[model samples]
Target: MKSGYNVAVVGATGNAGMVTLRILSEREFPLRDIVAIASTRTLGRVVSCGNRALKTQKISDINWSDIDLAFFCAGEGVSSKNAEIVADRGCIVIDKSSYFRQHPKVPLIIPEINLDTLEKGASYGIVSTPNCVVTPLVMTLKALSEVASLKRVVVSTYQSVSGAGRRAIDELYNQSKEIMTTRSSRPEVFSKQIAFNILPQVGNFYESGISEEEEKITCETRKILMADVKIAVTCVRVPVFIGHSMSVACEFSKALPTKNIRNIFEKIEGVIVIDRRGEESGYVATPIDVQGEDAVFVSRIRKDTSVKNGLLYWIACDNLRKGAALNSVQIAESMIKIDPSLSKFRKTYSRTKEA
Candidate 1:
C-alpha cells in the first residue's frame, strides 16, 4: 500500500536488538525510515543498520502514528508492557520475548514453518517468535510430521553463554582469561563459572521439576504445531560463545526412513542438513562453526534403534539470530508478503479503535 514501511527496533544496543538491526539492513527490508529504541539509560548510544548509525531513543519518544512496524527484543518485562501498547496504536509488533509466545491472540511463528498463519491476521497487531531451541526444533519436527505423526520428542540442549545475553558473554570471556592466567574471577552473570565448565540448568526449575527453558521449548513447539505431542527436554548452558546446539530424538507413529530425512530438511527454507557420512561424519554441525550464521544447520541424522519409528539428530544455530532477531525479521517479511501495508494487523487495530 505504500512505497516502504517505517520500522523501529526496540532494545537496539543489546545482542538480539543489534542482530535484528543488522538483519533488517542485510535483508534490505523496505523501510521509509528506521529508528533505534532502547531504555532512557542508552539514549546517546548509537547502533548500525547497513551503513547508517542510529542513536537510541526511549519508546516514549517515538511517534507511534508514523511507525508501521516494530521489533521488540528487550525482554519479557519490556515486551509485556510495550509491545501490545505499540501494536494497539497500529504498528505491527514482532516480539522476541517469552511474554507473548503462548498468548492466545498472538501467533508464535517460525516463518518457514508457519508463515501461513499470517494469512489469518495478527490479532492485537502482534506476532511472537519462538525460543532459539523451539525455532529449529519445530522446523525439523514440522517437516517430519508431514510424513509421520509426531508422538514424542526428547531434546538435550547445549546452549551457549550468548543465549543468556551480552553480560553472560562477558562472564565467559573474563572467566576464561582468568583461568588461563592462573587467576580467579567470580561468576557474575551466571550462577557458576562458565569457562571450561558446563551447567546442566539453562533456566530456573519449576515445582514440577521441568526447567523454564525446557517447558518453553516444548510448550512453544506444541503451540506452533497445534498438537499435543509428548516432549521431554533438558536445557544446559554450555561455555560456547555464540551458537546453541541440541541433540534431539524423535518418535513418530509412522515409520520414517533416514534417507528421507535429509530431503525433508533440505526443503525447509532456513535449514541445512549436513549429515554426510564417511570422511564427514566427524565434522557434523557444531556451535563454534555456526556462530553468526543464520541457517539452522542439522547433522548426525540417524535412526534410533531403541524406539519404534524414532529418529535422532543434532542441530546448531545462532541463537541471537534465528532464535531471536532473524525470527522477528522473518515474521515481518512474512507480514509484508501477506500485505505490504501489514493491513492484516493495521486494519484489525484500526477497526477496533473505530468501534
Candidate 2:
C-alpha cells in the first residue's frame, strides 16, 4: 500500500546504514518512502539511496508510527538507547547492533541461512542481525550442518577496518600513508597501529580469554543455527579496508568429503565456491578480492586430518555489506515475504514523534 511502508535508516551517514539504503533501492523493495536518520549533529546532511539523495533526520525526530521498518545501523550505544523504543512503536526494527540480539523476543537472523525463523512465532517488533564474523561464518556452517551434524568448529578471522566504523577506515588509511611518507603514525582507533600489521584481538577479552567478537560469533552462530554445537572463534582485525576473511575447520558427525562440500555450497544461493587446486590456480579469496561483493567466497577446501570427519575451508565477504547492512535489508525483505502486513504502516501506534 502506498499509504505507507515508510522506512527509516538510522545512522544513515555511517558505513552500514548507507549501504542499507543503497540495497533497498537497488533491489527496488516495494516501499512507499525512505528516510535517512543520523545523530542530531548530522541531521539534514544528504545521503544516497541508489541514485536518489535523502536528507538525514535525527532518530528522535522521526514519527515511529509512520515507519513500517527501521534499520538500526548505528553502533550498540545508539541501538541500546533507541531500538526498542522505535520497535515498540509498531515499526519492525531490523537492528544491526548486538544490543537486542540475545533478547528472547528478538530473532537473530541471517536471511539466507535462517529466513524460516520468521515463520516460527511472534516477535517484539524487533529482529536482530548477527555479528559480522558470524554472518559469513555461519552461512557456511549452516550449509554444512545440513549435510552432517556439526560437532565442533574452529575459525580464525581476518576482519576489516570498516567493521569498526568509518573512523577506523580513516585511521587505517592515514596510518598507512604516514608510515610510508613520514615513517611514523600514532595508533588512535586501534590499540596498536593498524597500518602494516594485524591485531589478534578484535575487542576486549573476557575473563575466559575469549575476545568480544569471538563471544558474539560463538553465541550468534549457535543462536542462528539453532544448534548446541561448539564454536571456537579467533577474531583478528586485519589491515584490510572492506572485506572480512576467515580460515575455518569443522568436525562433523559423518565423513563429508571435499567434493560433496563443493557441491553443497554450489547449490546454495548467495554462496560461491572457488576451490580448485592445480598447476594453474589462483583459487583463494583474500580481503581485497571480496570488497563490495555480496556473495560469500569460499576457497581452500580440504580435509582436516587431525579430527575424524573434519573439513577445512577459507571464506571471504565484504564485511560491511553481507556482514551487516545487506543482511539487515534482507531480513526486512524476508519478513515481508513471511508476513505481508509487516511491510505497511500500522495505525495502532501513536503518530507523534518518539517521546
Candidate 3:
C-alpha cells in the first residue's frame, strides 16, 4: 500500500461536506493532504481538519488529477456539473447527491448492504450514496431479508430539517423563536411552518402524488436490496435537527418470532436494537438521542397484526453522519479493504503523473 492518499472534499462549507471532513479525521483515514472545496462564493473560507485550518478552494480551480479521491457533498447541481470531470481526470468520486444515483453506470451504494456493487463501480470511478432515508431502511431490511423472505415494506419517515440543508436548520431555529415571541413565522425553507408542526411533504410532489423523497426511498431501497418487494413510503419534515427516524412495517414470506428478529438485528455490525416494548427500560431511541451516533438504532419491534407474517419497528440515525458523510467515508474504506491493491495503484498513478 502507498503511504497515504491526497483527498478533496467538494462543498466543504456545507453540512454534509463538513461532516465528511470531520469523519475523515476521526477515522484517521490514510491521507497525505486534504483539500476543502466549495463554490466560488465560499472560496478562501476556512474549514477545520483536526487541529488545522484548511482554506476552501472553489471547485473550478481544483486540479482533479492531483487528488486521489474526491467526496462530492454538494447538491445535485454541483455534482451533475462536476462529477464526471473529476472522475475522468482519474480521481475516484463518491457522490452524495441524487444526481447520478439512478444512473445504471453509477452504483447506488450502502456499504453495509452492497459493497460488491461498489467494487464493480470502481472500474468506472464513480459511486453514489443513497438517499439518507434509504441508508437505515435498507440496512434494517437487508438483515431481515436474510432470515425471512421480504414480501413488502411500508415506511413513514420523520426526517429532520437538517436534511434540507443549513438554510432549513436556520429556518427551523428562527421560526421556533418567532412563534414563541410573536405567534407567527414565515415558511420559506419548508412548504409549511416547521416549528411546533409537521409537514407531510418532504420534497416536491410528483404526478403520482408521492413526494420526491418518498419515491427515492422506494426506488433506492429496491436497488440496494435487489428485491422485488412491494414498498410504500410517506416522508415528513419534522422539527428535529440532526437525525432521521422511520416507522417501518414489513411482511415476510413466513412468520418470524420477535426474538429471532431482534437477534438478527443485534448481530449486524452497524445496527443497534433498543426494543423494550413492555417495560420501563427507557430503551427507545429518538432522533435527539441518535444525533452524531453512527449506528442505525432500531426500537419498538413488534408483530403487525394487520398482516400475517408481518413485523413493525422504528429506526433513528444521524442523517448527516451515517446517512451522508460517514457512509461515503465507509464506501472509500470498503474500497481499500476489498482491494488493497487500490492504494498501490493510486500511488503508482500519482508518481506517473508527477513524472
Where model 3 places Cα greater than 4 Å from the true spot, the runs are: 341-355
- Tens-place lDDT per residue, model 1, 194-288, is 89999988878899988999989888999999999999999999999999999999999989866677788889888988766767336688888
Per-residue C-alpha lDDT of model 3 across residues 1-355, encoded as one tens digit per residue: 4578789999899999999999999999988889999888878999998876999998888888988899999899999888887887878899999988887767888887887776452255778998999998889899889888999888999999999998899999999999999999989988889999999999899998999998888888888888777999999989998999999999999989666777988887799998776786657999989999999999988889999898999999999999999999998888778775454223222323447
| Consecutive 10-residue window with the lowest summed lDDT within model 3 | 343-352
In the predicted model 1, the residue pairs found to clash are: none
**Tens-digit lDDT string for candidate 2 (1-355):** 2554688989899999888888888888876888999988887999988877899987778889878888898889998898778866788888899998887657788877777766565456778888988888888888888988999999999989999998999999999999999999999889999999999989898999988888888888888888888888888998988999999999999898656778887877899987768748567888888888899899988889999898989999998889998888888777777667873322233325334
For TM-score, the strongest prediction is 1
For model 1, the local distance difference test gives 0.86
Root-mean-square deviation of every model? 2.2, 3.4, 4.0
lDDT of 1 at 122: 35
Candidate 1 vs 3: which has more TM-score? 1
Q: Of 2 and 3, which scores higher on lDDT?
A: 3
Query: Which 10 successive residues of model 1 have the least lDDT summed?
Result: 345-354
Off by over 4 Å in 1: 347-355
> Lowest summed-lDDT stretch of 10 residues in model 2?
345-354
